[model samples]
Target: MQYLHAAISETLRLYPPDTKACRVDDIMPDGTEYSPERWLEYGTCRQENPFRFPVFHAGPRMCLGKDMAYVQMKSIAASVIERFEMNVVAKDTCPGICPR
Candidate 1:
């Protein structure tokens, strides 16, 4: 389910839990597509600059439940997938629109 995890992460990135971020810096150029791999990057991760993602806040204001939140999300996703089968319809697929 590595692909599934990546897809879910990409969804979160494209539609972040917090949409009203006041960016402190723009390491990524404007309009860049959401990429799950970028989340795995060291030093350059968005969490490095809390203002880039205010959902968990940053610095002294960082959320103590951030890690637990992720754990809960993953657990729920895994539980749901385990109990239910999900399928993507071909009609919903867009070809060549996303970089591979």
Candidate 2:
């Protein structure tokens, strides 16, 4: 179960369902340039979604299924791996080229 949780976490880290997020310019600080382009960073995770594009619903109206999604992914993946010995069909292929 521990390993299953770890694997599921890793999967989500690598391939997040919603790629990026965005927020509006709520506070336009003085003496700073306010560009709409600057709204990129808030929605993206530093390592995961570096591009800061709109993959998930941005702003206060975000995805309500965040927790549910995580739970389902972990449960389904753990069950499958625990029940059977599964392996990738093309063993020689690099995971970088495919969905890890």
Candidate 3:
């Protein structure tokens, strides 16, 4: 479970799906407006690629597969790293994929 969590954490650290999420619909009794701008700015900082953030599909209807996704990714990554110490053979500055 720890390994799984680690893998998911790493993936999320890199490719966060939503990147940023905001309350599109106001559900508050006070009709408070959710400033998407604020969330975007916060998300940008939180979006420290190669680092983790808190925008893991937050809200009342967030993703339920969050844990599962993390576990699966971790297991696969752990297995690969355990057996091999691989390196990328990129020829250009942009290796196409993020150099994670």
Best by TM-score: 1
Estimate, for each residue in 1-100, the C-alpha lDDT of model 3 and write its tens digit: 4323433454554445664545694356756443323213322312223222554555565668866765666678778878987776775564122323
lDDT of 2: 0.47
Best candidate according to lDDT: 1
Query: Backbone clashes in each candidate structure, one number apiece?
Result: 0, 1, 0
TM-score of 1: 0.49
* Candidate 2 lDDT over residue span 1-100, tens digit each: 3334444444543355663534764343553342232222333212223235323445576567755875787778767768986777898865322234
Clashing pairs in 3: none
Output the lDDT of residue 50, model 1. 62
Model 3 local distance difference test score? 0.48
Residue 12 lDDT in model 3?
51
Model 1 lDDT, residue 57, Cα: 76
Candidate ranking (TM-score, best to worst): 1, 3, 2
Stretches of candidate 3 exceeding 4 Å from the true structure: 1-11, 18-55, 85-100
CA lDDT scores, all candidates in order: 0.60, 0.47, 0.48
- Give me the runs in candidate 1 sitting further than 4 Å from their true place: 1-9, 19-34, 41-47, 84-100
Clashing pairs in 1: none
- List the candidate numbers ranked by lDDT, top first: 1, 3, 2
